[model samples]
Target: MNLTTFLVYCVIVTFTPGPTNIVILSSVQHSSMRQAMNYVLGATMAFGLLLGASAILNRMLAGILPSILSTMQIVGCLYMLYLAYQIFRMGSAESLEQHPSGFASGLLMQFVNPKVILFTLTVIPSYVLPYYSSPLILMVFVIIITVIGFLAFATWLIFGSVFRSFLLNHQRAANTIMALFLVYSAVMVSGLL
Candidate 1:
């Protein structure tokens, strides 16, 4: 693989705004850095697991990718909509108290997050597999991708931390914007656009 191309794809996908990142930002804004970090840890684990699975099952998945992708898209879209609703309703820290942004929620979110699912599924085959077939190499790539993902989540958390005051002052507006972004993400990934 062209290292530059692979790095670019990985960075672009993970760093871009998505459901996970939005939630991380929201978590930091509404909760605490500890909560955001917990979510990031879970997300990082799930990301690594997905990449490992992709690398191991590349050939088998190729035969059934269409079915899998369609199913995932449906599930992912619905989940995203649910998250959007939750975000839309979270106007205050009190409201967010009931909302879960912990490790389990973060792990579950990745499984149903289209942006993450698609990236994990495609990145390995498109970039890593083509260039390296060794299990060791594949594992290394997975670790690298997971680290990138962790960094992306961390960046979002830091952003929210930096703007916590503004976000708290405009809590309703911030929630609305994040909710709308999640909705837009859902629509875009639903194959309806």
Candidate 2:
């Protein structure tokens, strides 16, 4: 396996604007940095599980259960729309409190996240290990990707957290920005479906 190729994949996947990052950014803007960090942890855990499962089962499953992929895509797209709505409806940052349940909610959200699952099932297998077949090597690759993803997502959350004070000062403008993000997410999801 080429380390450079894996690193490139990690950079691309982690840096892209996706549902996980969107949620983290919204949460940080509305609540606290600590809550956003919890979300990062939850999302990282979920990504790890998906990566591992795809590494172990993607080949057999792809051949036998093609419908499963379609189902996942639909579920993921719908969930993203729901998340967008939730963000669009939220009140100003000061009125919103950090919820303890956000950690679990963040983790579960990744399960239905089409992009994450697709990357795990396709990109990891195809680009990361085009010729390699060793399970240990694949597992190591998955772990590396997961770590990179965690760091990248955390960076976005931190950006939101650090700028939250500025957002709080201009409540209406901040809400408008978030509402636009919701619309953007919805449009992206519709394109996917």
Candidate 3:
């Protein structure tokens, strides 16, 4: 088991920009830290669950993951569009109110995120299975990967927090930019891009 290689894979893939991280950053910039934290928790927990499922189901899921992922991608695309609309609407409102994304929405987003699902499906086979065969060791790997995932998300939140004040002052511009990002993410997720 090359712990270094496995950890490196986890860091690179989990930390890369994706729907969950984008949403988290937008949520923190436009909403609040507490809301962002809830989102982070939801995304991270669902991601962890997906990792475990992928690891255990392994070959079983490989045959089916494509179809499931397609469905999820469609759902994810629609949801991302909706989120974009929501962000645009929030900015358009005469009085900007914090309509932070909730836990359930966050959780659902993760389930539908192709990036997460595919990452899990591949990671288990490439990193965990070869290195650790026992169920116990696999579970430990899952836990470790999940923590890494959480930390990756936290980094986005921290980054968004850094821009909160600027976003507040430039609400309309910020919202527009963020909403466009969501829209782009939707297109990418749906394979239009």
Candidate 4:
């Protein structure tokens, strides 16, 4: 509830690089800022939904469907590996002829992301617990976290958008970066398993 603690939580959740950010950055390399913004919006909505769901179902989920969480994590890890393969195998834009919209992809990706669930289940609740007795207070905490998440993600998307041209110009280097990111994602996903 304290400002210091809230800020610390935000920093940890928003600033650390994760699969979502990596994917957004990759999208930016092939799409426009507008598309990236779409991804951000979808991602932000997912965060809010997760936060609200955690508020309502934390106890029930923990007690009845704990294995479900583990299954989600494994599935998410496999998906990340799949994404890595996609990135590495991607053909040039001229060959592909169409760029997928980042927004739609971003929105859908959040549904399967294990990190988002982990964050909602773990970090988000801590910020809300102090205000548990009051509905208004809890809502306020969720709103604050949601807003901060949106802003932080927007910043990253904008950064990637602005630099997308540079990435496109250097296709080889960009692919190399993508490969590295895929490896990083795989390692992170493995930790969950």
Q: Which candidate has the top score in TM-score? A: 1
Candidate 2 lDDT score at position 126? 47
The order by descending lDDT is 1, 3, 2, 4
**Selected candidate, larger TM-score, 1 vs 3:** 1
User: For every model shown, what is its TM-score relative to the native structure?
Assistant: 0.65, 0.61, 0.63, 0.59
Task: Tally clashing residue pairs in candidate 1.
Answer: 0
lDDT of 2 at 24: 75
- Candidate 2 lowest-lDDT run of ten: 184-193
Residue lDDT tens for model 3, 88-120:
665322243443576776788989997787677
The numbered model that scores best in lDDT is 1
lDDT for each residue of candidate 1 in 83-104, tens digit (9 for 90 to 100): 6786678544333333468898
C-alpha RMSD (angstroms) for model 1: 7.1
Angstrom error of the Cα, residue 113, model 4: value is 1.3
| Residue 79 in model 2: lDDT | 49
> What is each predicted model's overall lDDT from 0 to 1?
0.72, 0.63, 0.69, 0.60
Query: Where in model 2 is the C-alpha error above 4 Å?
Result: 59-101, 161-193
Clashes by residue pair, model 1? none
lDDT of 2: 0.63
Clashes of each: 0, 0, 0, 1
Model 1 segments more than 4 A misplaced = 59-99, 161-193
- For model 4, how does the per-residue alpha-carbon lDDT over 165-187 read when each residue is reduced to its tens digit? 55457757665666556455444
TM-score for candidate 4, residues paired by index: 0.59
- Which digits, one per residue and each the tens of the lDDT, describe model 2 over residues 45-105? 9999998888778545545775544454444345444544554454544444444426787
Q: In candidate 4, which residue pairs get closer than 3 Å at backbone N, Cα or C atoms, i.e. clash? A: 39-103
